[model samples]
Target: MNLNKAWGILKENGFKETTKRNQILEIFEGDERYLTARDILDVMQKDYPSMSYDTVYRNLATFVSLDILEATELSGEKHFRMHCESDHHHHHFICMDCGKIKEIPLCPMDLLGAALPAYEIDNHKFEIYGKCPECK
Candidate 1:
């Protein structure tokens, strides 16, 4: 949610307290947009010259594994968003024509959770494809 909270989560996940990691959190905090490895690396490059793309990727993977972030595929690229512990879970909407991604509030599971009697569904993903408002 906030920088201090994010730092605590990373620390609990065994992430060392470093300037690079702090900067990464800052970037996410400042923008609500979901970011891919390239997006993050590009921003990091502005402030941190020694930061490598590989390192950014690795750190993002670790954050996802630790449940500190959510990874989604939008517009054919992977994106990461910080998972605020108290926030309600939701899905995404992607515009196929203009490459716009928006967070959709409804969780379809509320409607389908009872129908899944034959199989165990640990988790599910729902993405609706269409033109976004601006693209339309």
Candidate 2:
């Protein structure tokens, strides 16, 4: 999502604009890779030396709750990226080395659903992790 849309969502949800929040959003703007809290902290510390992990994590939680960002576990730690702007449903292939994401248009559920015909499935998330070509 774009910064303006993110701001609009915040406004619609009765959130006031703040410099820190804007900066957080800017970090994800135009970047299509997932970022860890440490990654954010590294960038933020340059501008606000006193920034704490708690503060960055709190905002990350807020963004995820608001659906402005998407979260995933990478190498046992949580990473986040801006919500996908695609109009179609899809999953992703994440690069382990670079954090780059490639959209996967095929849904594995199509095959899995057939195998679990007796059970009801509510939802699912499928992601493939590997090195991207450049990283290789």
Candidate 3:
């Protein structure tokens, strides 16, 4: 995504666009993979040498909060990916070795919700992990 699209997304969420935010978004612009804070920092620090760890973390939290990004905790570390909501809700099968993502056709919670009507469901996150074709 270009700077304009990034700005547009931020504006749609009522967030003011900034250099740092754009730089952060650029890291995932054309990539469809999970990235850790350190992974992002390594790429960002090349241009933004003064960027701090806290700044990357804060921006990540903001992106996740704004629904522009999704975070999944894997192996005790949080990994982030761009979020694009489709008409039908689904989950993902994430390749642990390559960070490749494959969309799951159905959500398990839908069936669970039907089975447990009394439970009030607020949110859900699902990710399956394994090796990708190339990795295998």
Best by lDDT: 2
Deviation (Å) of 100 in candidate 2: 0.5
lDDT (10s digit) by residue, model 2, range 1-136: 9999999999999988899889999999967899999999999999999989998999999899998999998778999999999977889999988889999998888777579877888978799989999999
- Candidate 3: where is the Cα deviation over 4 Å? 1-5
Give the C-alpha lDDT of model 3. Answer: 0.82
| TM-score winner between candidates 2 and 3 | 2
Candidate 1 off by > 4 Å: 84-86, 94-103, 129-136
Runs of candidate 2 with Cα error greater than 4 angstroms are 117-120
Best-fitting candidate, measured by TM-score? 2
List per-prediction Cα lDDT, in the order shown.
Answer: 0.78, 0.91, 0.82
Error of 3 at 2 (Å): 7.4
Cα RMSD for candidates in order? 2.7, 1.6, 2.1
- Cα lDDT tens digits for candidate 1, 52-126: 988898888877887767788876789887764457787777666754568788888898867979898987889
Q: Give the worst 10-residue stretch by lDDT in candidate 1.
A: 92-101
Deviation in Å, model 2, residue 99 alpha carbon: 1.0
lDDT of 3 by residue, 1-136 (tens): 3446556777998887778888788777767889999998998899989889998999899888866788889899999988855657888888988897888989888678578678887887887889888888
Query: Distance (Å) between predicted and true CA of 106, model 3?
Result: 0.7
Model 2 lDDT, residue 16, Cα: 84
